[model samples]
Target: MTDLASLLPGRFGHLVRQLGAFGGVGVIGLLVDMAVVWLCLRGAGLNPYAARAVSFLVAATTTWVLNRAFTFRGARPEAAHRQWAKFLAANAVGGAVNYGVYAALVSGVGFFAAVPEAAVAVGSLAGLGFNFTASRTLVFRGA
Candidate 1:
């Protein structure tokens, strides 16, 4: 089967390629996040919110490395520590947006009230645009 990005043409091509790379990396990060949350809740017997906090950190770190290496390559190189900090700062707004959406979906919608994970997925997507913009413009502007 043809790759999904192959469907895009013209000015959107570069963005589509970047977005595809980011998305692939994001999937890996999501797996890490979910696994950490599961392990913290099940193995460590942590509260759900506490588990989520830890999982978010793990996922953010993973995504930062991957995004710097692949998705935002060609950008001016900064120190690893500095870049990581910038990544964290840039993503904070996105994180808040994600959480707000998730909270609203789970608490305000009857359908999502019964299936919270679906709300999580929707919330995750809600921040994608802002995250991409911040990563490209504020965090990795040299590219």
Candidate 2:
């Protein structure tokens, strides 16, 4: 843990540590996702969108492993494969929320449409809270 992570408040310290660790895993997952997508697109010559799907699935699995080992260490003991499935199921809602928010923002707001990347960022942020909640409370309960 960094100095910043070490400074987490006493009462809600677990939440802070989990969030920080989750963020780190997310960064790593992003890299893995990008690499997979690149490989699918450039090496396999697959459709760009399909490549994204492949990458997304890979990254989801990677993040589940990382989160289980780090962010939610000592969570309810269960089969590793089962835990990955649970993570995916819980994240489905978060993914929908993110896509819905992105679509709504880009279509409903002229400013957001003009800067689609910003709309995506907003959508991502909107889903973060729900994802964290679901991951901590449902997917990795008893941590």
Report lDDT (CA) for all predictions.
Answer: 0.88, 0.87
For model 2, give the 10-residue run with minimal summed lDDT. 1-10
Global Cα lDDT for candidate 1:
0.88
Index of the highest-TM-score prediction? 2
lDDT of 1 by residue, 20-66 (tens): 78788888998999999999999999999999999988999999999
Across 1-143, the per-residue lDDT of candidate 2 in tens digits comes to 36664677774877787887887887898899999999999999999999988998999899998998889997889888888888888777888988899999999999999999998998888777778888999889888
Model 1 clash pairs are none
Give me the runs in candidate 1 sitting further than 4 Å from their true place: 1-11, 102-122
User: Candidate 1: worst 10 consecutive residues by lDDT?
Assistant: 3-12
Q: How many residue pairs clash in each candidate?
A: 0, 0
